[model samples]
Target: MFSRLANVFKGIFSLFIKDMERKNPEALLELEQENLRKQIANFNQGLAAHAGLAERLMSQVRKQETEERELHARTTAHLRAGNKSAAAQNALRLQSLARELEENRRQLAQAEETYQNLTKAREVAVNAARSKIEALKGAINDMRMKTAMAEMNEMAAGMVSTIGGSGDTLSRLHEMVEEERTKAAGRARMARDSMDMSEVNIKEAEMDALADQALAEFAAKEGIALPGAEASVAPEANRSMGSNPQSESQ
Candidate 1:
């Protein structure tokens, strides 16, 4: 039971960590990059050690070659001197040096091959890691941009919904402003109607009377016959004739 509980807790922790890694991929990428660097460093150290071994093998081969040459020269010198024992001893040593030289050459070749393989492997690994890192960077940037766009879309949708809703602030403000404008217009009309207009009416009537008198005088001066003027003059002439019987008799 305890082991089961521990497994459950471990699973929960792992899920939590995975969630964090997903949410913060850049951090994960950095961690992977650091790991790559460490791997490379370790790889380089191993390469250096291998190179040292190759160098040692090269040195040994050179030493064996030099010994073989010296021993052969000695063997020839001893044979010229007719010292058979000395010559045979030098020849035997030369044979051993030759064999060691061949073995050293073989080992050197193997070391070189190993070193080249390791270098190539390290290069391949580094390249693969760098490529993956770059890809992750691009993915993270795309995800960020997509997230921002999604958020903006959501905000815009919410705003649109809010604006069309009855409880929208701007809509309420518009309604309030329209109502105020209507009220103001009604109030203005009421104020205009309530104001005193007796003086204005009297002044207008007087102006009309003056305008009519002026029109009559202008018509008389210009000798322009008006429709009512002839009737009025004929009546006046009749009255004058009645008042003056002498002129009427003449």
Candidate 2:
């Protein structure tokens, strides 16, 4: 069972590696990244607008404050002219200017407060994208790995797809995985045979030759390597018995 799972993992992993190398799914990764960037851009624009408004409001307050100071100065000059009626009128105008300036100052203060709050919000929004970007990258990598493994299976003797009349994808995936596993197991057996042959301290010349040459020479003199021992025929039948995950899940 573990062998079967190992095979499946290998098959799946190959697809992922291929995708990563090829950057085959660039569209998917780009689309997600673009979405996050757009949101951040929108937030920045709002913050910029808010800051601009605050600046404009402060400028208005400065102008009104200056006007209020000038109106008071003029009213004092009228009082010193010994014109009581004119002085009274000037004083009333000065009071109105003062009130307008005070109101403008209040508005400027509120605008500044709002701008500060927006600055903080903008920081928070931009900071939030860091985690989102990382997550998107990881998701893309994972998808790439799967796509690569699938392609590898196609290149190998394994079935790349099960889109045929009666078969399905999951079954085909398992078949491919098992096929790969058997090939691996065959290589393992050959390595073991070579190790055993090396231990006997056979003639250095004999060992120098390829294993195939030594095996052939021994076969002619005596039955050496088992029949078809060189054949890397994997146990396709054993793996054929396993069910495909796609079907199992269904």
Candidate 3:
């Protein structure tokens, strides 16, 4: 039953913590410290209350001891004055009250001891709570710093990627422009250096071959078989081989 009550309270407290976290984490942190302080205060208050009770009990015990002593002296005086029965009754009442006070004092001492231990525990708990808060705050700050650095690094990477892409695109554009210029230079040479003599010689050789083929075609059409013979006779009658010295002597 006691455990069940403890669990119920724990669940309620956990819900409260979650709500605090959702509302304002920083505020929740402060609230947690406040809670620690409250706990310490409560502990100190409880210790003080028990100690106070012990003090009051001790005061009553002292008063009771004095009254008992006075009662014993009266009972002895009464017995000595020949009132034995009344003295016995008075002594019994005093002894009974003394026993009760002493028992009360014993309980008060036990409670005071428990309070002293609780005060010590409260001190330790406060120190531990404060240390935990400090560590958590440091961790939170470090995490924030690391998060900021990570974001900065990511932004830098993005900028670098953009710059690198622009560099590559510009370099490629320049290369393309140079390639077009080279192609244009080649076209200009094709236009400026039109057919020179060597090019003309090559075309004339092609034309000569074409004329021979045409003559062969015409000979075939007219059924002539002496085209090669006519061509050979014409070459032999065309010009002298060289300026001859024998021809000058003749």
Which candidate gets the maximum TM-score versus the true structure?
1
- Per-residue lDDT tens digits for candidate 3, residues 1-250, read 9999999999999999888786555677787889887877887787887888888887888888888888989999999999989899988988898888789779878877887787788778888888999998887777778989999999999978876785677768888999999999999999878847788788999999999889888887997876576788676765453435557878
Weakest 10 consecutive residues, lDDT, candidate 3?
A: 237-246
Q: Model 2 reaches what TM-score against the true structure? A: 0.46
Clashes by residue pair, model 3: none
lDDT of each structure? 0.92, 0.77, 0.83
Any runs in candidate 1 off by more than 4 Å, and if so which?
186-250
- Looking at model 1, report the run of 10 residues with the lowest lDDT sum: 241-250
**Of 1 and 2, the candidate ranking higher by TM-score:** 1
Relative to the true structure, candidate 2 has a C-alpha RMSD (angstroms) of 31.8
Flag the better candidate by lDDT, 1 or 2: 1
In model 2, the Cα lDDT at residue 9 comes to 100
Provide TM-scores for the models.
0.75, 0.46, 0.53
